[model samples]
Target: MSVIEDALAALDLETKVKLLSGQDFWTLPAIPEIGLRSLVMSDGPIGLRGIGWRPDDPSIALPSPTALAATWDPELARTAGRALGQEARRKGVHVLLAPTVNLHRSPLGGRHFECYSEDPLLTGEIGAAYMAGVQDQGVGTTVKHFVANDSETDRFTVDVRVGERALRELYLAPFERIVGAGAWGVMAAYNGVNGSTMTEHADLQIGVLKREWGFDGVIVSDWTAARTTAPAANGGLDVVMPASGDPWGQALVAAVRSGEVPEEVIDDKVRRVLRLAARVGILDGAEPAVAESARPSTLDGAAVARKAATRSFVLARNEGGLLPLDPARLRTVAVSGALAADARVQGGGSALVQPAHVISPLDGLTAALAGEQTMAVGARPPRTRRWSTPPPSATPSAPTRAAGCRSPKVHSGPTSPVCSARPAGASSSVRRCPARTSAGWASRHPACHRPTSPSSRSPRVSRPPWAARTSWRSSASATSR
Candidate 1:
């Protein structure tokens, strides 16, 4: 038996029950007695978004999975994976919830940008390579959305009616490859596969994944995916993410104690969790064990992102071979569209990241052609959506009359600033943006402005919670643009 197995055998039933659920949103509870440390997981198929959703914090943004697949090269995928693993390590994350291997069954899929290809073979090969690369860095990779989670429409409750043969041939193909590649973790999807919810799907979890393919990795429920205690627990789900207020807490423990669910089921799930912990160096005094190694040398992500973009471009058509023009022969290049000046690096959604810098098409062309390029606003897209501050209400009864209610410079949006208020000789008091506070407090609140004495250092302005929900898309967009 392995050392992890030995540790598992020593644990009692109560502690084992605790292991079956997460301690927090992004991590599992640690048992210091057994030397198991809390394991931190993050979102990524392309890049890591640490525990918090702070867009300002910098993270390496690689080419999207579709862009990586467009290259049709598994080697590049592996290189991208290595960079991702290194970034995960740098951020103190042990597991990356990535390599979304679900096949692209339809174009309208909201998360198609995050997936690899419509063809299963390509997704499988690329996913295997990416998983191998990530696991190589002593960080675990989660081959996610177990089966038939192709589209985001009705993702949480949509019951998919797929034929068995087609499902096996296409949908389950990538997962089989990822399991064969020995991914350390698997995330069950929110949608239902066939008639059964994936989180509680017995056949897929116990029959196909665990028995047939021999996937020993931990099976984590998608955030709030597990709906019931008995079904999900018996169905083979190991952990519930965002640990607070989950269905399987004391309820699951009580069910096990009442003989409604066997204790062995909980033991099996705990074993898988511990096994993953041991592999990722979370178990104290246990040597870190990776299923595979990607490469010995660390890779530069920014350099790879530039190179991958070059190869991933698909030339659908070129009239009269008007392509690959010699830089010397070209005098002045004419470019159009605002996107030429500002490129969208990745699609928006859960995986969105504000990269440190993105080189627009205009910048690239200018650099390549020795500053010989001119741009024209042939037609600019209408700014249908923008977040300028509500023009300071002309009314005198507004909140501006308060002691420190000065409006800070409003840029793209009103970044709610932390306000400092002092009355008479009393100490200054600070309060975060009270926009959501009671209506009565907004107009007369004295704590709504900057410090009395502004310092040389700029005060950190924070975007409101609603800013994360705001997103826009242009009608015409190009990879280079």
Candidate 2:
């Protein structure tokens, strides 16, 4: 028997179940008796955001996946992946939860920037290259949102009713390609595909991904995505993530005892986890797929990122002979737009990471056009003021107030805080107010109104539900891209 099988044989049902559930937000429990060590995971595809979200421990931020795909160079994508893999090793991360291969099915998808492209073939090739590069460095990669997580609208509950033909040809193509390219992990998305939730979707996760395609790696649920013990286990979800509200642990052991989930099924899951551990060099006896000495040498992250950004630039239209503006002839240059000043380095959520520094377009142009008078204007006032995470001591129950801002009530929804009205006697100066909540600050915005608790606050910012559309649109009179 293989080392993985021997280790699985030694583990009891409860221990095996424990190994399948994450001990915390970014790691799984280690079974020392079986020579298993804790497996650490981090967010990736752009940069490696280790375990914490802090500015001091910043990561080397790369261009968005969309930008990388625009370059149409799979080799470049592979190089970018190598950089990320190096970052992962430096931070003690074994698995990178990234390289989102979901197709750009809708323009309005909230995470469109995070995905590669609308074309499945392009996305697949790029994703495969990226995965290969990361794995080349001895780290594992999870090509994510496993099949058809194209849009964010009601994503957790919406049952995407896609026909088998569309699924095979379009939605599932990228995952199929990536899996075939030897992906080490797959994240089961939150939403249901067709009539079944992906975590419990046996037909695809087991029948297609494992039995047919022969994916040997672990199938982990997207954080907190696994909702049932037996169904998810039997359906082929190898692991449930983050200790919070996990469906697998003791519940799974009970399911096994009751025969709801077979012990052999548990063994299969454990076998995959142990195999992944072996590949990452965390398990004892098995030879790691890539040795530490074989990893690619140190990479210059900034240089690689700069090259990628330059290559990805697509000049949509440079009408007239305006081509490259002659620096000698140029007397004055104008830069406009709020985005020009406060550039969003990356999309929000899992893709967010603090780079050591971000060179805004205005700053870049200003440096290049030195001595040439540069004028900058915002179409709207740059959102200078915003909410931020309060110190650990400050909580919703304590109700701490920011200097010159009112103590607003904390709410439970995932909406951003908006100051509907200016606080009484407050100056127009920008203040970094804390939008306190049980889940930390959900969002931050320019402070204008007093912060209210959820109990006292009235419904504010009443716009049509569709007002929060993801597409960029401007008025007919406006003159900006």
Candidate 3:
């Protein structure tokens, strides 16, 4: 145990981490010199990051948290916990960041499909189940996004700004129960709670999580989120993750040395991390069995997907007859969205899974309608025909087809750009939108169209392209229209 403690002393924090990795725990690394323990981390309240868990690592995914909660069985939660823990063991992963226990504030949460219900009790019950199983398997489980990591948009910067009563009653409850159930670790969010950063706010991390609730587990800073290391450490955050490729670790050591922070603070923080590692058998002499041949399920894992989809489908309005989608007599469907083909089952960033195959609403609906008899009983099935719109024909246009292959972006630009298109069963021809009124290119486009106010200009980007291009005098003038 002193190995880590002494490393913390003589070796710089980076060197300490480097040394930890140098001591291999299990499965060999692709780069042996980098070492097996260079501090492995994983996602998935459901399972390991099988894709990048490591090429040599063997671990498959389990059901999403939402699906697991549907079983409403703590045993399932524990099994899920055990499944992930076993998977964690396979990879020699030190931290399994998971069990997103944030209360379901709204059904609109994009990631909620992977999370539990809007009720804190349900979230707590399920989160605890996962925490128990993962820790039991000798790999640490980190109950995550600590306080109010509810929304996906602007998640890192949103100011939660809630009252103490509301925070305790709703958002913090699941974490409290999970802590009580022995979650060995926690991860703080990037958002500000009531004008204070969750990582630096001594009130929640220290006053509430540590002292009040008695959470002895390690508190991890959200990836790239430890702004003031000293304040965060003093606030009860134990780890600054995900060991960003920068000199921030060096800064932490320097801060400790310069008396900006006390070494005792570092000791306390590191102790928490070490204690969990010890609990999870990381520092033990056991030669953890390296997982063999385990990878994320290649078989679409439709069972898991359908199960997850079914559980996440809330019955918000049972007003009368809007139940199961009718499979019979559902013909001549007028579809609109391109998303039907490319359904966004998951979000864009870190949580994405390279699924073996994706089943879109179009695919599901098609299958449903295909073999069924007519709306009437035993009637012969109707022949189904599907076709996208035919491209227009007019002036000579840009080549929008690759060897006559049609693409969606073909119509993205100015209608006047004249595009060569070939709809199925139609002869190749140069074409444009039908109406004489053309859709011309504005600088920013879509958002720039029909601006109501100057303040309505692009918030993320510099300014709307058309803001200056158009002859609008003032913001008031723009809004007046």
Query: 251-362 in candidate 3: lDDT tens per residue?
Result: 7677777887776777666556555554554543323322224322323234544544455445668755645655342322322223344444553234433444557655
Model 2 RMSD in angstroms: 12.9
Cα deviation of 382 in candidate 1 (Å)?
Answer: 7.6
lDDT tens per residue, model 1, 205-258: 999999999999999977766667888898878887656547788898899989
Return the clash pairs for model 2, or none: 387-444, 387-445, 407-451, 408-451, 408-452, 408-453, 409-452, 409-453
lDDT of 2 by residue, 188-285 (tens): 98767766778899999999999999999999888766777788889899998877777678888898999899898988898899999999999999
Off by over 4 Å in 2: 372-481
> lDDT (CA) for every model shown?
0.70, 0.74, 0.54
Off by over 4 Å in 1: 53-57, 291-295, 326-334, 370-481
My TM-score estimates for the predictions, one after another, are 0.76, 0.79, 0.62
Q: Which stretch of 10 consecutive residues in model 1 shows the poorest summed lDDT?
A: 472-481
Model 2: number of clashes?
8
- The whole-model C-alpha lDDT of candidate 3 against the native structure comes to 0.54
- The local lDDT score (0 to 100) that residue 122 gets in candidate 2 is 96
